[model samples]
Target: METTQHRVVATGHADWAGTSTQYQYIGPDQNKHAERVSWKGHAEAVRRFITDLLKQKPPALTDLSHLAAVGHRVVHGGDYTTAIQITPDVRSRIEQLRTLAPLHNPPSLETLAAAEAELPNLPHIATFDTAFHSTLPPKAYTYPIPMKWTRDWGIRRFGFHGLSHAYCSNQATNMLDRPRDELRLVICHLGHGCSAAAVQGGRCLDTTMGFTPLDGLMMATRSGSIDPGILEYVQNNHGLSAEQVGHSLNHDSGLLGVSEISGDLRQLEEAANDGHELAQLAIGIYVHRIRQAIGALTVTLGGIDALIFTAGVGENSSGIRRLICSDLECLGLELDTEANTACQPDADIATKSSRGRILVIATREDLTMVREIQAIIDLSSQGPGGVPQVTVSKSNDKLPGISNS
Candidate 1:
């Protein structure tokens, strides 16, 4: 029997001017191939990329018909608690979430539409980055705002990067040789988009990102948490409208805003090494905010069993990790300076004498999405008695592990 497995992974990014699509596939011989293209339109580019990939007749991926199923990494799923098949209604619901995730959902929808049109016969699944944080308690999710806004606007902390958090949590448990239910962890996902998560018993206790991706730790170009009063103050003083302020915060702020230079951390670090005051200040602010979040989330977990660093910066930048873990002896977390500077992925950089484990794990959100899609498919295929049944309701009352409040 042939044991080789075939799969395709595709991604579409909507940049300032246009869109780009990248696709990868594994052939029957177990060799891998990839291709990328940049074009003007998002949906059209995606369609063209897939069409071109098929024309090349990749070993295992001859065409869209060869795929068993398509799994999409949806940035926001709103109220959905699990991965679901992308039906017409589901697509519409995803479209409705655009306003909440202006930078993410639109590009996702464009790619999704292109894929559906190109491969109508294949089953498509939407695995949400927000779904894993659905386990957050009310205290963690609720904003201390007016009752009218809370009740009428559905405004609350909906954490982002949940897929990365979940993946890191699972990997951390495995690395620690402990059952996930018994471990409490603090996961720092640092990348272009950054956030922290406190996970207890495989469930999210709290996370840094709240309501929107813009509300978390400072990111590459996006400003992290900022005072709402600052917005109003700037509007009154600078004659900037609400929309213009939002644009600046989301695009022109963060490291770029503070450094008055490039947003790339590598660039900032180089400039800082040369005694650039603002560059050094930008790096300091970034490290300071991350360390602060770690302390807060450690308290949220009551104590931490393991501290993990994942994602791009977390996995690669040992200097950044060292900076964030500095002066943490009080929390029983110590980094082995030698191991950290080695820049090895999936390694324990904690000192032998350190009480708490400091680990660096490479995050695989794509694997998480694939597992979720497979789980949904497996559940649907089970016999009537094989899977437990539950009543479905429109009200939030039926959600598990969450209070109606």
Candidate 2:
């Protein structure tokens, strides 16, 4: 998130594992505050941090009474389409879904408990990463698996990076001065975990990710889509168990496995510059997958209007963007070398004659969460009649309660 003492905001910025806590600082001059603490330890940390900060002269919050509400970012909302206030049943359901996002939701649950204890009077809202993708139609979300599995197991494409995709896609609309529904956009979120989403008319048509976050793009450590037969073959031939296979796929694969070096792309790029073949291959695969995904998404949208890139690699890696956009001219996209090389995000970096826009947008999940939280709060405060009542399903797996503080 943010630097502990400096308040440089890194809220809603998640690592591969969701263990950090970032929130509104109970301090004056609070620009952005972040900490990586979790569980009972995380809860205790929040209580201590808040108590100590509020103890300052003329206190930042004038005690807890000045606080409005608490908002949390969840990584995998399976069914919920929007932000919801936390309740006991809701908290329990979130806990149950931990098996799906073991790395993230556990810490989020801990942080939630901690926040609840520390701020008992406040309403805590859960904003989901999967919330924005609830618009995926059946064809896009459905797996070609058995119908029984689909009906009983809730096995469908549950795309993620919703906050980032929602933020960037809307930003694309704003930058182009067009209404969202009027444009066909492909938003690529390239980070520790990557996914590409197809958004049209402010609705997600399809996304690369599926039942789990691990299903889509090649990430820093996780392998993207692969032949499931490989797992069976490894088990049937080798002595590795299913767990071992899963572990390797999730942790030992992707860039790290291919490059046989660091998972960080910067390191891979350096190695590639030094004539490392595998490093070159890793970069090649990464770019190819992105290009392929963009083409498919463009087709899904009927045509391309803008290809927006956001998140870590998308926002900063000019070379990666250039390589991915190089031969994509067939899709009516063209990268401007000069503009791309020195481009700062929230700007277009496409050639003037390119039929589709090439944009780099710095995603702000924190701001997305804020807007959603504020919307819920505004709805709730409109007296009893203004509050919207909706049912929350404890059905199957769902969002991880990642603490963005």
Candidate 3:
């Protein structure tokens, strides 16, 4: 009774998908196209942009009757979400938690609404970034906040980047042909917004992000893992309100705040190379925080098997990777000095002589979303009594992979 299902995929980081092809479509025959598309920045706008592009190709929008399900990348699930599936109640619950992740949830909600309008009968599923880390033990997830605040208000650590971490962990396991129960892995998902996760026995035991994506490692503009005392100090000393302090932390901080110039890592890298002291300091701080997280996750996991670097900064930026892994020789982790620096995007850049494996896996959250959607569709087609088993792997051991250049 296993029926085949097709998944319609979407992402928050839609820019990561087929950008070259999309650019080609919007480039020469369409400078005018770019101007019209420019105003379409929101998630809803992408649907129209996509429709117009499809219209230009065939000059018509195609029917989506064959689509089994749509998989959406939802950024936050708070404490209530665990897996990807949708019901009226689930969608409403996601909307209710919007205040927790202002930047991410609004677009996700709009996209959800757009999809419902655009494809009325199709099932939409939400794959949350926080769901994987729901496995965190009470100690790791618990904050020192009052029990009432956490229990009633849902104020606690709910990690982000779970989808990417899950994808990388599974991909690494499959690529290495290692059994899940036998592997311990640490995945570093580095980007403009970054986070790390410790996957033991193929489950997220610990991660760097907490409550919001703003907590954890320093990010492009996010003030990750900040102290609560700072807010009290700001309120008293600077006469800043809680909302104003939040705005400053969420928007005006991180690399942009530290460098006092830019949040773009590429720009920071260039400035650092040119001996800009501020840029150097920002880079130093970023690498230092990442290293600290890695160390903590390693301790949490009791050791490491493979350390994976994915996402924008993790895949291509070898210098930063090197900086993060430097002095970890004591931990038996070595970076292939040459392979790291020469690492290419969308490729696994693992060092040859490293004691523990260092891998560069191109994070494919889109593909993960597609797979999850297909799973949900399969489960749904089985009717009320049939629930398909979710085959999640269980090993989180530290086994290295063969060098894949």
- Cα-based lDDT for every prediction: 0.74, 0.75, 0.69
Q: All predictions: root-mean-square deviation over Cα?
A: 7.7, 6.1, 8.0
Better of 1 and 3 by lDDT: 1
Please report how far candidate 3 places residue 4 from its true position, in Å. Answer: 7.0
* Candidate 3 regions with alpha-carbon error over 4 angstroms: 1-38, 41-46, 49-62, 345-350, 378-405
Error of 3 at 360 (Å): 0.3
lDDT of 1 by residue, 11-69 (tens): 22223232443434333354545555444454554454455434544422343434445
lDDT of 3 at 118: 64
- The lowest-lDDT stretch of 10 consecutive residues in candidate 2 is 389-398
Estimate the lDDT of model 1: 0.74
Give me the displacement of residue 397 in model 3, in angstroms.
30
- Between 2 and 3, whose lDDT is larger? 2
| Candidate 1, residue 120: how far the Cα is off, in Å | 1.0
Clashing pairs in 1: none
Give the local distance difference test score of model 2: 0.75
Task: Let me know the TM-score candidate 2 reaches against the reference structure.
Answer: 0.85
For residues 265-351, could you state the per-residue lDDT of candidate 3 as single tens digits? 899999999999999999999999999988888898999878889988888788888889899877668877877777775444555
